[model samples]
Target: MDSSLYALVEDLRGVDAAQVLSHGVSSITVGAAYHRARDVTPHGRTRVTFRQDGIHFPPGDLFDGLRLLPPVQRDADQEPLKALRDQTRELGVPLHGWAVFLHSTTLGLAFPDVTQENCFGDRAAPADLCPSNPDVRAYAVALGRAVARQGMDSVVSESLHFGMFGHGYHHERSFVDLGSAAEFALGLCFCPHCQARLPGAETARTAASRLAASVLDGGPPATELPTVLEDYARSRTPIVTSLAADVADAVAAEGSSLTFLDLTGAVKGYADGRPTGGPAADSAWQIGVDPSAVSDVVPSYAILCYAHDEDRVAEDVAAYRTALGPDTTLRAVLRPGVPDTTSSDHLAAKVTAARKAGANTVDYYSYGLVPLPVLSRIPH
Candidate 1:
């Protein structure tokens, strides 16, 4: 869509969309809901009008717009890209591609070697992969490249981390290779390499073997964690680091430009005698940081929500700006339609707050969760 048309749309201008797309839009006004995390539905449904066509897409037709389908295996997944690219281009909106990195949903079938085990000696995870497996790393890199080749505007690695959930570290009975408690706190990989390496190489098998020997299995050996963590980071970072950098490289090769965003939770919040924490909007950045896990490779975090409290939106953004440094950008998600909240209009207010808090760019959920009318609350 052309900026003139987008302006027409923003101004409620009565103009032809067809004419505008053939041209280009000068600016954009994004319409979004508080959340796009819709629950399981038989088909994808976007609850509002797409700026591209202004057609209200039913759930069935929304999947492609959301990029939920798989890319063409042989075409480097670029087969169904024209429609997606055209629609986005017509709308003058940038895309944020979502990819579930280390965690794959293809268990019991594709790449089962990395699946985690349980006390029953059976695969415990549904389809999640172990982060430390080298093959798994390669798979992630390949998948990223595939997506990048498809011309995604920006890539967000959704779940690039250890297993989703499990119980006590059962070295002899579970699928995960456990490392020291510190490693666990800081994103432990625990594959054979990680475990064999205790601060670093203390895999479940090694830990059990050593523990069984009754040598007190004391402290993690010196030079163990730093060395192991560095290696772990190197191996793990490529999965994402490569994907992000690859997208940039791929776009550059084609003489195009794209942005790569990384998200994760670096700090923990204490409460209820338990350590609970929120995850990143991108999910993959939660881990031990090295230049690889996060580097110039990732430009910024696309969207961030504190989950516990949206009122803290400004504060969280402020903290990230300070800790990560101002040049590192952030996108703050706002939910103004909370059932009984009266503090402020959600999207616009949050956008304003983010700017005041030093955020230069922004992205938010669309239509269903947040309507276009919400823009009134945000002062342009």
Candidate 2:
């Protein structure tokens, strides 16, 4: 199960929240570090809550020498994680921490140099920190270690890969109709760090610039541009994989495992839960996530099986299972209601499908966001 600090501290309190969240799941993962969002918490103290982009705990010595430090959340003083940790301990339920890395508007705005710059030399996504940057890598490792230090069984790492252009900002406006290929081209980073790290970065940037320009001028989309961009995108695998390895090492040192959260399914299926094209795993490369590479480094993964159909969910999980191999632990994340699910039976079928497809664990999407009745749909 996934939850937030506000849900634990303000909504259900400590023990009550832990007991409520522990109902059908073996472990509970809370958002210890997250990006900015305004979510409607159906059962929360407030009908809606605005979450700031920052860590929920005090950094202390975690980021002592790091240039790209995490911003502390406004409610950090409440020590929600600490309280939940104690409560879960009493309930004998393992507590895990969910940390969003490399996707913070606060840090990106504060240190523009660390953000991703596109082919046009403009900041592509102000909220996305280029993973190729040394400081960003260090910060990610430190953040993982910090979360692990809270006595978590594992740290579920989200947004560890590159951000897409369509979902980078809130209320993002684009009057011009940039096609998927154009958006992909514009989202590529040509910053100094990416240029220094990726091979043939200059050539890729030039191709990307021309492709984006052509699309903007209503010209025919170049067939070769996406292929070039994809080749360039493959070059980012090492950077993200190595970063995951670093974070895994850091978390392991603190006696906790790292679960790499791949949001490809969510990107494809979040709205209506009917994702088209190839399996989510096949498209993961576009976001710098090479499942095989990442799985080799991090033994555990959390795949967002956000689709509604059981067959679709199974297919997505099966692809990830093949990519990750049988040795790695695969956790399938599902939504209990709305966009993805319509009833308890619908949710249960997806869960069973995921497990049969090689998911060792089936975790629900959220605690506060979904209604209590919807949460009850989780297979025990």
Candidate 3:
């Protein structure tokens, strides 16, 4: 199995790179573009870092067919990605660029029209850029091509589809009893761009609005999604597939492959350990993701195995293996510490489970977020 570790630019300092490399990791997935992060090191000092509106590295003169809404920024002095890329190359380890595609609070807040609009007309989700929006689509395409141009062996795409209401804004305090289904209904984008694609979008919007309103008024828990809304949600599959195709093409042009990271399993695992089976596995549809459909577009898929139980993580990996078929490259991402992790032994067991479950590769979720001692958890 291919062994890799996810890392931030700052993690390339001093002997940190050498230390991680000593763990027998074959590749390093560096975060080229990302969202806000709050991490604590072994020293007990916690730091929260936020990016304004751009990439860690300097951009090329032209984006070819891709475009950015607020323009891409860079920190030349740090040259984070480039420096890390060189460091990994010297160690004979391949470097893959990890890019956060659509979740941009800065650009979304700046361009609310392109942001996702809930059924209740709440465009408060500043971190979620609507996939149906033409500009956002172009931006994602551009991001993939740009990251590839940085000489990465592969590009791991994150948040490439629809984001929910639970993902955005700050200091959210909800006392209302908005159940999962109602909250999901309210998170549906009713923007003009989305409406133009679905035939009965307006009707679905009305139904969703009523359901959300009922829940906000302290109604019973929403057990299921309205049929109209469900159909509307499924319609997002094609949009996401097309976007993936564009990104695949962009990555190909740069001689780098695209690895689509499906967040559906992670979503389900985090929100009550419900298995993503039956109509629920299709909940990925709600997020504009259809993993099986995208397999034809991208050559590889990285499924999130964030569940607490090692057995549960194995099951999640097996499901993706079955869905993506035998030929598609399947990689599993594991969080060694924090959240659910207890010890390095726990991480080792999970890694063994992933490999036995038919994963072609296993990758650690992050390098900077976890402390140095925890970083040693990667099984050599």
Q: Against the true structure, whose lDDT is highest? A: 2
| Candidate that would win on TM-score | 2
Per-model clash counts, in order, read 26, 0, 0
Expressed as tens digits, the lDDT of each residue in 220-273 for candidate 1 is: 322233443344444444444544555455445543333333334322321211
* Candidate 1 similarity to native, TM-score: 0.54
Output the TM-score of candidate 3. 0.92
Q: What is each predicted model's overall lDDT from 0 to 1?
A: 0.38, 0.84, 0.78
How high a TM-score does candidate 2 get?
Answer: 0.95
> Which regions of candidate 2 are displaced past 4 Å?
1-17, 220-225
Q: Global CA lDDT of candidate 2, please?
A: 0.84
Model 2 lDDT at residue 1:
37
lDDT of 1: 0.38
- The residue ranges of model 3 lying beyond 4 angstroms of the native Cα positions read 14-16, 43-53, 64-74, 271-282
| Cα-based TM-score, every candidate | 0.54, 0.95, 0.92
Candidate 2 residue-wise lDDT, 71-138, digit = tens: 99777888888887887799777888899999999899888888999899998588989899999999
